[model samples]
Target: MHDELPVQESGPTASGSSPASAPGSTPAPRNPGRADQLDRRGGLDRLGWSVLRPAPVVCLTLVAAVIATGFAVRSSTAEMGILIWIDAHHTPALDGVAWALSWAFESPRAIAVVVLLAAGVAWRCRHLIDGLCAGIALALTWGTSYLVKLLVGRHRPAWTLLRHHVGGPEQDPSFPSGHATFTTALVVVVVMCTRRGWRVWIGAVGCVLAAGVAASRLYLGVHYPSDVAAGIVYGAAAGYLMVRATTLVSHARPDRRAGQDEDELRSGPGEIS
Candidate 1:
């Protein structure tokens, strides 16, 4: 009689359950689907991407510094008096220039136009993310400043505190200067939005315009120096956030370890050699 080879009976293992793990061998990955999802998202959790990608730590640090500075400015009597004195000493030519800069650079209509134009340029260059990032920065910065205004409820400088007023009265809370924030945002957006010619020129022009807008708020005696400072810092932070957030979302560099784990799971355990 020929020797018969033993037949292995799979029993319950026939239903496709994995073999039970022996003590402390690295357990097989329980969720290949989740691993795949993570791989698709560059193998990072949301918080991991938010903190690790695009120098988020630096951006966060800048934001913290600005917040601290805002608190310090709010409490300094000397700082308050300095701006007040500057307001009292404004000249007609300077006032006109300031008002013009504010209206030309940061008016609602002007902002809309700039964003739309930036979008057009970015689309033409096949880099739509830049445009989207710019829009987010502008909207986020403006919204945050507006919310702070409402929370602080700091009124505009008393009309009597200055030489005189020319424009229509602002009838809203004014702790942070909306013009300052938006103008700075505009500058950053212009610098970042497209790889077109004249970007440097546009950025330079934007910086001058932003500076002028900040000065105009002081010259018009409508916003405190602290308000302008806070607006500038907030705008910078918003731009930094926009750039990093966009990068974090768009990046898809595969993680070597995650890819390996996923591959191993998909291939299943190797047969004993």
Candidate 2:
């Protein structure tokens, strides 16, 4: 018999040795659960950076300003003079306008409505981050307004001067007009959250609403000008800072798959053989 050549395995045989992947081949798909975990971790990291970067300084500054204004209003007669001047100039016809404008913010309902609307808009846009930011900003505005009102402990303008006012069984202290605070904060957040193409319209509408709310408080003679002014300042600051934080976090770098795809493309066959 011819000398039989020793049988040699040409490829992976029943022994089960597999071929090594090519050097530049695409990696195996990542585990779905593990990938989601990584994404969540990265999101948290971005959110932390966004919160830590500028929020503390800005918030502290705003808090100091609000505190100073609160003290000044409590200890001085200037604000009273301003309120008296505004009250003296009220017109009967304006009562309807003031009442209508002020009605929305008469309670916490208008703020809640705005928060819901903002969330709805974000959901429509498929941007969950925007919704979260809007909700957080509005909540912060409400909580801060409540705390500051408690801390300031200033009473509302005297009802005797409120001739053109609408109906009320009002009981809240009014160093900072809650209506003004909520409306201003709502406007700021709405404008900031709008897309560039829609920003002008949204901003214009927001300004109209905020101005109407502020003027309504003065016309109703329920809030001193100083109270509304402080509310505007505080609310605007809170909305702006929160929007900035959310924007920073939302702009985190895209998924790693994009980079991987680019690398694969660069390393793909130069010319199909």
Candidate 3:
């Protein structure tokens, strides 16, 4: 008869957990319910994406329209009327929100924070070119607004004209609001960095936030309507150009796209990292 061999236990280990459940021993199971929901939502969003496939053209057309509208109202000071209306309707709650939005994205500091965040995103995707492109694009967008402010040399709206004032004096030229420009430009970069399934949700929310910031400027009695409008137009155009530039770079370097696609596929639905 063969010698009796040792009979190792086939059940839970001494730790009282199954051997297969040991740390790093087996892959964690996916949440089927959540995964299915994401899949369905992602499918629906893709149809919308398909409709907006010519996004660059659409964006340019809109920018032109905004520019025309800005010119139409530049002389009328109708934007001042908007500020007056907002001032008339100010509630304590809205005042708090407006103050928060106005202070949240201050320039230079805001630019630095966003650039670092963009670089971090690229690092997470393991794509160096994307990080560089996003940083440069954001810098250019901010700088463009600054230079325009100097060129336009427009003064801030009169505090006296606004019966109720909220914030301190704004020293910079009031044309092309810095806050509005920064917020708009930042949204574009954020939407670009995220996954396709997440882009629509993020972009829509970001647009709403950008609009809020723009309105806050008018509410605070600092900016003319034309200033914020031009900021939005420039921000969107600069952002669209940045996206196109990044796409061209990615196409030129197929290896980057392949690596990113691989990482994206490995991650579960709606996962950022």
Candidate 4:
């Protein structure tokens, strides 16, 4: 019988020379998959994109335009003329309703509703991209409002009266009411956060509140009609821009990341599985 040669078992590397040539040596190549997994995890577990891509920029631009236009059109005389016209036509009962609405809009109770809603959304949608978008919307509305108010320096109805009188409108210019801005912001924000028919419902509420606040400014004799009009324009611009910004950011977000994020979030909370 021929002498049996000792058989050497071929391990993964065969000659045990290179890790790359080993039987299961493709671990490094699998990094892409792992990275993909992590991306998904991040998307799902953390607030990733903010307000959809180019939205933040677009919103800022739009707000600037509204402010510019509002200031350019400021005229105490025009404001007073509108007040006079409304006062001349509407009944005292209607005015009273407007006044009541004005008070309600600024009340802490109204704000509380918005705060609660935001908080609830945040908690439920922690991993959702939209939560970040919602924050952007709120910030855009509020930031622009204050900036416009300061820049326009429009007087309130309470401080001065509108006069279509002889000397070309009053020097005390009141344009762009804060109350209107607040309500409009709330309405836009509410609409953005909800879906389907909810938008309509939210919009209706917002409109009512905005109108009430605007009317109160007039009733309280603190803001002119023009002020309210400007406020509406400002609010709408902020709302529209915010929505558009959200759209842009959504589009720009990396598609690969979103899926990974979702998967990681669903598979129990840990690092990327």
Which candidate number would show the highest TM-score if scored against the true structure? 2
Give the per-residue lDDT of model 3 (tens digit) for 1-273. 856545444434566453454444443333232223323433111222345667767767765665465445445565577778878998888889999998888765786766696677667556555566667667777776687677667778777877777778787777778888888988877676666668889999999999999999888888988888788887877766655554444434424334233322332322221
Clash pairs, model 3 backbone: none
Per-residue lDDT of model 4, residues 22-106, tens digit only: 4433332212222233243222221122425465465567667767866676544455656665545555676567656765655
lDDT digits (tens) for residues 1-273 of candidate 1: 956545433212544455455455554544333223323322111322334566556666866675566555554444556667876777788878877876665557756865785576456444454356456656776777777677666666666655567575576866567888788876765555423355578878888878888888877777778888878877766755654454444443333444454434331111000
Q: Backbone clash tally for model 4?
A: 14
Cα RMSD for candidate 2?
A: 12.8
Candidates in order have lDDT scores of 0.59, 0.63, 0.66, 0.54
Model 2 alpha-carbon miss at residue 125, Å: 2.5
Ranking by TM-score: 2, 3, 1, 4
TM-score of each: 0.62, 0.66, 0.65, 0.55
RMSD of 1: 13.0
Error of 2 at 71 (Å): 1.3
**Deviating ranges (above 4 Å) for candidate 3:** 1-76, 246-273
Error of 2 at 83 (Å): 3.1
